[model samples]
Target: SGSTQCDKLTSEKTELTVTPKELTLTTENITATAGTTTTLTATFNDDTLNTGKVVFKVNGKTVKDENGKVIYAKVVNGQVSVEYTLPESMKAGNYTITAVYTSPNSEKLTAEATLTVAKASNN
Candidate 1:
């Protein structure tokens, strides 16, 4: 061979780290009747990551929707639970309830449950 050339190179690389998936609500399907109360509970797979300061919303409404209102909600040991009291005056129908959770890392997540309101019985 008249001429030859060779080259060698080496480099260091850094990898980016990503956080694990946050907690989520795993409960759905709720049934109730007019003039009665229903309690729905949702459990999170990763409880340690979720703590105080979780927000709950129904049909994009903070307090009262076009039809109903949220009675109460609380987070206990990484599980977010809510109790909704359907007013006796409310018309029987189907409603969609949602729970929006804000993680400590400022990530927004949502959980949904279906609420079926049965007609009041004539007694």
Candidate 2:
């Protein structure tokens, strides 16, 4: 017995839209007095699950909690924040604040901002 078979192939063109990833860091309190606490916020913009942690740094030094452990803030709805208290003895000047975002499904992103610390009040 002899059998014959025929195959047909079809293709369709598709388009994909790509956008650059972005991360922004800012301070809720742009200026804070020494010995006072301020909030650092990080927001991630990407096409993936935006749940991750943020590592904060000040003046090129990693910020740590009182327990001597690295502080990591949980990201919710693409935003995360942590409180940082300016040292009482810190000089009154501008400081560079940086935030690094880490996630299991996305590449690491970083952002920087400036914070001005004022001299503590003498009240």
Candidate 3:
């Protein structure tokens, strides 16, 4: 039997491209009065692929419940919302309402809307 020797082989380089995921938020301007509850909906681009939590803010401040607990809305099928009740002491004016979203593997996304608070009618 005879032994054979083979030369070294070289391969060409291959290139691959990757794209990052994106998220978008949408919300509508709403009007409400103190002591009244309003539904704030935050819709995302992907209907079935987004998973995260949304935090609602007003006038650059985080929203809190009566017990002073911060509110966090969980993303469900790329949509999440909260029932926000205007505080009785809230002044009647246009407030900037923002919804901030955060996920484990996604960049933070934000949306803003104007909240028009009408003066509570004295009844």
Candidate with maximal lDDT: 3
> Per-prediction TM-score, please?
0.65, 0.74, 0.80
In model 3, the runs with Cα more than 4 Å from the true position are: 1-21
The pairs that clash in candidate 3 are none
The lDDT per prediction is: 0.65, 0.77, 0.88
**Global fold similarity of model 1 (TM-score):** 0.65
CA displacement after TM-score superposition, residue 21 of candidate 3 (Å): 4.9
Worst 10 residues of 1 by lDDT: 63-72
lDDT of 2 by residue, 1-99 (tens): 744575665889899899855555444336888888888887665434457788988989988988879998987777788888877888898988888
Candidate 1: list runs displaced more than 4 Å: 1-19, 63-74
The total number of steric clashes, by the backbone 3 Å criterion, in model 3 comes to: 0
Please say which candidate is ahead in TM-score: 1 or 2. 2
lDDT of 3 by residue, 1-123 (tens): 744686677999999888856768987799999878998888998889457899999899998877989999999998998988888898899999999998877669899999999998999
For candidate 1, the per-residue lDDT at 5 reads 72
Lowest summed lDDT window (length 10), candidate 3: 1-10
- Candidate 2's C-alpha runs over 4 A off are 1-29, 46-49
